[model samples]
Target: MAHIETPTDEEDITDPVEAKKVLRKVDWRIIPLLQFLYMLTFLDRVNIGNARLWNLERDLKMSGYDYNVVVLIFYVPYIILELPSNYFFNRIEPRKFMGVIVMGWGLTVTFSGFSTSFGGLLVGRIFIGIFEAGMFPGCMYLISGWYRRHELVTRMAFFFVANDIAGTISGLLGAGLGSLDGARGYSGWRWIFFIEGAVTCIAAVLAWFYVPPFPENSNFLTPAEKKWLLNRLKSDNKGMSHEKMTIRKVADSLKDWKVLTSGVLYLAVCTTAYAISVFQPTILRTFGWDDLKSNLLSAPPRLASGIVSVLIGIWSDRIQRRGVFCLGGFSLSMLGLFLIAFLKGSLRYMGIYFAAIGIYIVQPLCIAWCANQVTSSAKRGTITAFAGTLGQFGGIISALVFPSKDGPQYLPGIMTCVAFQIAGVIAAINLWVCLSYENRQREAGKRDHLRELSQEEQDQLGEKHPDFRYTV
Candidate 1:
């Protein structure tokens, strides 16, 4: 394949595909800061789980399904605002938008620690929802803006590791902090909220200072390095040039069946993922361990999930295939669910925790895959947000299953999660098979349109060749 060099503004670039490749290059200097920013995002979002293990509800006198209700409140404004949040991310400056989100959520996380009543906690969680809601999709939008579709899976896994790894940290911290339940007149669960929430505010301060804007607007990159970046993207075909998307454009981008399928696939994974995220520590409590031990035990499964995520990401990239990883990983996650569902308390089933690792794989890979599937870069960003937001609808449903009264044994919730993981696997297979068949047909020289037609006859083909991808 012939590559096109990045053209200067002074020149007219030929081969739009080659020009597009020039736009996908990443700035290495900024990635580490972004990773930490995402780390903070995950930490603040999942710390509520740690609070659960620390006996937060019991301390506050939350009963019945009240705990679940508190957790569910965060997702309300979160899901409702995602589309506009992402649109704001792209339209406004990401560095500014993202920093504000980080700082705002940090405040909410801190206030959550001081809530003395259900109404107060409800208010805190709602603030958390409003603040943290835009941070993720905004950050993801920033990431895809910086890197090309192909280079993103492993990187997204690294970024998402922040979530699982944050889970581990929350577990470890929750355990240690619960040991301080009676210290300084503060309950251990309250301290967990106080400490973690405060840390997020501090991290938000750091994000304000460190998280840079899009590369084209970056100060760190030399003029020459920026040129190198542009040229490199011109070598990949996914456009990253200066272009903005309009509302009508976003709607038009949804015309493909692939968009609908990708949304469903991700929703399935989110159902299981969110189910486990908020409830994992509580689930471990059923093993007859007390608050501290249960919180500590929650760390291992998350660490296991993080470790396997990196390996699966590398393997998925190495194999140069996205769909295989999505299907295989979800299958393993489902298997883990089955083991936990049936074996209950057996040593033979201990590996169920390790199998949870597979669930982590689909998130990063499938996210990267779907973002790559669309042709228009602006359209791609909106689709990514749409898929993520739609997927979060699972959170609403998953939260309803883990009742506080079901304590010491939440089998119904775990089984519910298992069913969703299987559903994701099936959806992934549907997408994989569809894309594979499309590729084969193109290889066989079947144009779908009449081959005998003149170039002008197939107007809708626009510049898109069959090489266009689908998210597995």
Candidate 2:
């Protein structure tokens, strides 16, 4: 056996076989754990809604306003802490940082089972919001460190499908847990938190080993493989990896136009996604079904969403156009909302499938799209975190929009979502125009250059490198 020399940018290996081999290893060792953790994370977050169907509000004597308030409180810390949490993840040990946060949230959910009053549930939700805030942005930052810009949307789709899968199964799990209402002197809803929370804790323990840190710090990769991986990424993105967090880098990320516009786009889409996540069960119940039946039927739309997200991701990757799909996906979402809003009977019910597809599928693309614009490792963390933080504002709007008075048709909420979906479409168009103009500028600058910079210099310049192009 011979050691392969560390590749320079000019000599970077882009062999399909080698790329596939490494990707497969990463998929096997990394993606599954992240997916599972996210599944649990999502399951914990939404199961409270299911618990409401099982008399959660009644059990605690929670007024409609109180219930909404409790739900709203969670997003407070979720919005405030996201950027700082992600920064901590970037600076700290991934396994420990991620594992502790996972465990912390799981414990929070577990204690939620014991809540005897509205105040208790509020306490549980607040802490759950605090710890779970880090999960998506942190995991995303980690995934970006591994894949090239073109490859990111698919990987993000793979990872985000967990939310859809969790949505699909969380209903079934809730229904099944409902059967345990009297089990061991605990209510079924209580059992849901206890059992799901415990599973999350177990996943956290496994994550400590399975969720390897940055590739450079991984124990699994050989020196040759690390060199090849880093160089290939460097060739695709000059500042893809090998950077530490610093104050100047953080400030630069905040000042970037791409970061501001991308965050706005993400916030728009997230408003739609968060609304769907919380209200789907209640919305499905309007189809004249019982609780169990509503839970069961809700599964199909999410399953469709999971399937559509992956397929759309593959298509987006192949086309190498993120903003186009974002625009298309959000446009589809608006149509779905219109169908659900104005149509009657089965047609409106059918709209769930379209709505689910539109909302869930666009999520991965939004995250990947913002991430692709920032090439520096530290800036990636800051921008992704900032975008995620802003998106939490959508969650706040989602909570308030679906007031209890708007039962069955819920026209106001539906219309509000339609409006936001339209906003999301507009945001997508803006992102496309911005990226297109910037990429043209970069291309033009390259043509006017007097001399080519060395690979090292280009790598140091990152997304600002004259040869680097943004993924639109």
Candidate 3:
């Protein structure tokens, strides 16, 4: 068992100065390393869309549906492996597990560069999805372990900014790599894979040594610091127990209605996010811009979204609220997508900026919102994976909606995103209602049965414990 040292007083344990010091250390040590890893993951996943502008489909003799099929295949392995990988992530030391995942995906991405036919590229994408299955969910689980619920959104935002940066830089990188066209007899698209994958591979090797595990086992902290950190989190919720995860626990965690609702909410958002990330470059090219100019134009919208994500995260944490921010973000996405679906020319270009801002900001908030509601470590892992696994189907939805048949307008795809954005808003409101009602019930002493249970039993009950109040 890990050592647990109790401070003589709660005030000493939560001293503002000491808490700030630890927060800064964790932000610097933990967040930066994970940020780099997630950025690489996003780069490899969405760069296929970037490849399209450079004649990747024509070079490989791929039909329009064939391209969609290739994109679709990635989600198969990604969804199937997410839950099991997260389960194992908690069982194994995170450094080894996450390192192996990063390296596996990096290798697969590099191999994708060597594909001579559509079949080879298909196989590479499948493996890339499998290897990447655990990264985002695992990162969420890991971040939850370090920070309290109120402090979580900002940290998650910092981590999520990597996704926006990846989207923005994919454009810049795709443009620069275009210069490498015909070098070593490979197209610019191939060099995008080769160079980015090589860098990911190097970063993965370093992550094994750098990425810290749960706070209790972290090597960078002193023994007293580790105990203090653990105690501080435990006081926030008793369900953060050291007990080993079990099959029953995993099943029970999945049975929560909130998990399903959260999954649906995220599913609605993911379609919009993946669509924007994967196809925004192609969308820009339709405006009479050449390959380089389209890629350059793609950067600003995502850059705006990234900057706003940090600000929203800080605001969410400051006010200790999440659902309203999510609702507002999705509303922005709805307006943006509606504009894109109906408008043309310069006005439509303005829609892209609005859509970009709305699409990217909601995702991190949703993840952080879900993370705050769960109490147990194992349950947190399970729900994050469950939500992620369900949300990944949105990628498939995106692939199917935007066939090349739609061309420059892509009205069906754009409207599909608009409809989902409305659904996401509704789901956010519903979650807020249910959570608030539950908190009221707890305040009214409706969970008196919790008083009869021992500490271990109360811990096992997780969010069901009477003292546990859901974050709205």
Among these predictions, the greatest TM-score belongs to 3
Q: How high is each candidate's TM-score?
A: 0.88, 0.93, 0.95
Which has the higher TM-score value, candidate number 1 or candidate number 2? 2
Query: Which ranges in model 3 have alpha carbons more than 4 Å from their true place?
Result: 1-15, 454-456
Among the numbered candidates, top lDDT falls to 3
The candidate 2 region of ten consecutive residues with least summed lDDT is: 3-12
lDDT (Cα, tens digit) per residue for candidate 3, span 148-264: 888888998889899889989999998998668889888888988898899999998878888888887888876656777888888887476655567788898788877777688
Ranking by lDDT: 3, 2, 1
Worst 10 residues of 3 by lDDT: 3-12
lDDT of 3: 0.85
Candidate 1 is scored at a TM of: 0.88
What C-alpha lDDT do the candidate models reach, one value each? 0.72, 0.82, 0.85
After TM-score superposition, what is the CA distance of residue 168 in candidate 1 from its true location, in Å? Answer: 0.7
Question: Could you tell which candidate, 2 or 3, scores higher by TM-score?
Answer: 3
Cα lDDT of candidate 1 equals 0.72
**Clash totals in order:** 9, 0, 0
Candidate with better lDDT, 1 vs 2: 2
- Estimate, for each residue in 291-399, the C-alpha lDDT of model 2 and write its tens digit: 8988887788888999999999999999998887887788778788888888878898788788879877788898888888877788888877888888888878888
After the best TM-score superposition of candidate 3, give how far the Cα of residue 288 lies from its true spot, in angstroms: 1.1
